[model samples]
Target chain A: MKVIKITAVWCSACLIMNKRWKEIEKDYDVETISYDLDFDEDEVKEYEVGEKLPVFIFLDGDKEIGRLIGEKSLEEIKKYIEELN
Target chain B: MKKLLKYILVFLFFFCFLVNVNAKEKVTLYFFHGDGCPHCAAETTELIKDLEKRDDIKVVKYEVWHNQENSAFLDKVMAVYKTKTGIPYNVIGDTAIVGYNEANKFEIERALEYYKEHNDKYRDVVKLIKEGKEVKINDHYSKQDDKTDKDTTITIPFIGEFNVKNISVGSAAVLIGLVDGFNPCAMWVLLFLITALIGLKNRKRMILLGSIFLLTSGLVYFLIMFSWLNIIISVSTSILFRTLIGLFAIGAGIYNLYAYIKNRNQDDGCDVVDEKKRKTIISRIKKFTREKSLIIAILGIMALAISVNIVELLCSAGLPLVFSELLAINNITGMKAVVYDLIYVIFFMLDDFIVFFIAVKTMDVIGFSTKINKYSHLIGGIIMLLLGILLIFAPGIIMFNF
Candidate 1:
């Protein structure tokens, strides 16, 4: 199973969440695709984000599986990961 | 020969008389100041020293509380004037100097100028008072009963007083806030959120989650900081404390930039799994929980956010405490602790909230996090560098004149 983790450079919470996700990836095969919002207008619009950042979306074979918004703890993300597994 | 001697003696006598008259300017400069106020004392000392060297200016110093004769005058005047404080005021001729130091200097100058211009007029009034003569109400000098000119009728408490130092602090805080908001450290945090949110396949969920995260992080940071401020104020004076805070801000700015540059080159190089694998993994995580439980996630993220903004928050907390300490040390009592802390926190938060809102809005509008990624390190570097340099050097700049 592959997991895609999207992130940005400047978000403190995102940077933190990214670290947690990376740790999770150590045990699980997760594919993290990081994007800078400054350069990716289309991707941002496709997500229909209002004025918030550091959103996490879980997709399974082009189907929406789960979504996490805002800053989340490592344990919370782990729980989400467990659910998916 | 007799006529010539007599004429010369008369001319000499006239000349001598004129010289004596000119030398005795008799311009009494009354400086009213409080014993408890540091700035007032400083101003008083400076004024006394400056006047002592000048032959034309006669300085008469009055303590508002100690001078019983002037108490009635002060009360009568203050009863009509609307201002901050009634006592510990200055009256140089007709000009009133309130506050201390630079403010008193300006007021003194204005009063001296007025005395120079209206010397004869004020002399006449003084003569009447000394002779116990009944003086009539005039345009320039009016009785307390006259209220014709509404504009002039309003009682000024500390009219003609200038508190330049205090005013400067206020202006500086605003400038610092502006700089802080635009600082690289803050910008980096904003950029990260924007980029991360944009990458989500489910756009709505991404936006919702992102907004929640940013808001909660900001709220938590400010709340904790404000609470800490209350704790600090209980121990120190606000003015000295604020100066220390300013120094710390500069330090933090420098550190933030340094950290950003140090970590710029590090990469974990974790391989990206294919879309199929990513989806399968996401589905498995989804199957575990239907309701999104972000409490744990929020806490974790909050910790990260705190780590990133620890410097900034500390600086923020320091500023209010320092200012409060300064005010307290200056013997500005009567301000309730809660009210004082509340005002400081409100002002501090007002500055931060504006920055946070702008950052979030800009990211949402731009639609991509690439810009954030590109400039994060650079912004962080510059902000930290500038802040550090400013903090370290500002005290020297302030003390240089001394």
Candidate 2:
């Protein structure tokens, strides 16, 4: 599974997610791609990211499957991943 | 032999010169004035101007309007002199000159001259105060040296002249009130009451009920204090009774300290009310409030208030008892006693007001109330312990004079 994390340097909520994302990736063996909302606007636009930074776009191959917005706990993210079928 | 005698005479001459130089007699006059008082400001300026030329006279001006501590000190000075009046008050040696006038200024200068000649009179007072004894001017310093042999009692303001020990009544009231205000039992009862009221969803009713509860609590507390006051006035001269009260304070303080240490981690205990008793009261309140009639509900609320007051007094009675005991020793009576009781109740209700106001407005958004409730024991315990020890050992600390 490919997970794209949309974030910004100034976003506090995004910084929080960045911390949990590191631990989640190490434990779950998942591939995570981080895109900056400001500098990497092209990738963000390509993925149809909204004004909200700190969102996670889950994808299988090139097609977007689901997304988690705002702040989510490790369990919440895990639950969303399982439901992505 | 002649040369040695000449050297000895010269040495003696220099020694006497040094002694005379040191004996210039430096007097520090305390001038307590209020802020924005035209008379005080003018008087202070004049006093300073007059004293500026004399290096031997040092002026210490305490602004009493904005400073409660300074104001309290002023009150202490007044009480000692047996003068009840306003400020621009000056204290020099044994002389306390109230209000700055031409005559008073002359009187102050004359007094200063007298003290310079007989500096030994007030020097002991200055030394005692420097050593942190709760020495007051009218009581300790102003008296004639010849009368010292006869004077046995020491007068401290607010607490008055007690045979056993000296403590201030006002500061004691504040400290005990603050500690009592944070009683876990009282806080629990308040929280319970608020939660029940919130369920009813009527803000008006909640306000009415809360006001009644608080007023009734105050009334019950005042009644207890009134009776205590009567008892105290009758036996105000009893030194043994005063000592017994002091012992009681020490014991109460120890219990609080022990309770805090024992239940440092518990959710529902702070020695103010036991867990079992608290649960029982809460259950009873729920059942009592479930009734539908307005008059019956009002009566139920009053009953709850009375019961909660009793429980709070049980758990947190140490400070109030200490307050009453202090009052008893001070010989407070008539309207003065009544006034002090009112002031004490105001301070006692301060915490309840803050907690309930916040609870009603924000509904405990930060869960701060819970956290305070958890640590109330530790905070209350420490205060009580210090107060208790002071009551037993050095009661001067109770007045905050040092």
Candidate 3:
């Protein structure tokens, strides 16, 4: 599974989830592509990130299955990835 | 030659004589106002009357919003006075009064009294700056904030006239408080707790435990908002800070709107807490039920309430921040401010109270429909959007002109 993460520097949730996502990467066999809401505007906008922060979009070879928005614990992140698989 | 010398000496004496302005000399009040601002317009009318009647204080008016010079001068005087932003601002001596109301009028009268009595110490700092002279600020007068005109005054648009009164902010407190009560996080905990409480055979323990939880939640709400109020009041909030909060509001509003749209198919859930935290809360609830010691159970409930509300606070950060910022901008403080926060806390707890009461009487948990919470996000989104825009462009309206 591929994860497209949309985050912003200013969002507290995004900052929080950033650490959790890194930990998730250590356990899960997922390619996580991160894009900043501001600096990487064009790419982030394509995802239609309609507010909230630290968006994690799960993809099955670019066909999006689901997305999670906002801060989540490491276990929750792992649970989502496992469910997706 | 002697007559000529005597004439020159007399002229010199006359010039130096009145230079030392007597105690009765009128105190100059430099008022920086906005032309279309409700508070400024309302204050202007009252100050004009004071100008007409009072011989000891002279009101100098500068229309800042429409005039470049006045606006720039406002910056200069603000630098000297160290007054925080939000207007209908008055610079009286070294003291800066940020808003106008009846409470402020009393403070102004008192300030004028002080300056008049201590005329030798009085300096027209604004005038000195206007004259391109160096000004040294030596005294700090009352740091007290005062109110504007009447208790309920209305103003005609573009007319710059108002008799004024105060009601709108209190109304805002009630309205915002009521709406803000429909928070997902706060509701979620109470829902979870009620199911636990309803299973209890002893109504007294149920009542005691439930009341403790709700009271703790309400206290946390009050303390948090009150602390924000104090921080905003104490910190000299610059335009930059206001702009940042404005941006945050807009961001939060957009997020709320997004939540409203996205949650159409999803269930009402707490996104802020993890499964581990949820389990911990559940375990704690179980302990509260199993504990034979009443004191231990009460303490546990209190701890649970405090912890739950802290997370709830995270989920519902937008309203309290906005509410406190609103209070600061409107210059609503002291006992009036305490009362406002109380109104907010009571209203915030209204839903939780109703839910708890219903659960006790009927021995069943009652929850608000998800639709209500959904629609609230939509409405809340719109209000926050408006407040955010006003906070940036026209803050005086946020001061509640109507």
TM-score of each: 0.33, 0.45, 0.64
Candidate 1: global Cα-lDDT?
Answer: 0.46
Candidate 3 stretches greater than 4 Å from native: A1-85, B1-27, B32-37, B41-86, B94-118, B124-164, B265-273
| Cα distance off (Å), candidate 2, residue B253 | 1.8
Give the runs in model 2 whose Cα sits over 4 Å from its true position: A1-85, B1-168, B263-280, B287-290, B362-402
lDDT of 2 by residue, B373-399 (tens): 335556666665665565455543342
Question: Docking category for candidate 3?
Answer: incorrect
Q: What TM value does chain A in model 2 reach?
A: 0.89
Top candidate, metric TM-score: 3
Q: Candidate 3 on B18-85: residue-level lDDT in tens?
A: 67544346688878777667777777787656665766678888876656667667767766765555
Taking all chains together, the TM-score of candidate 3 against the true structure is 0.64
Each model's fraction of native contacts: 0.18, 0.00, 0.00
Report per-candidate DockQ.
Answer: 0.11, 0.01, 0.02
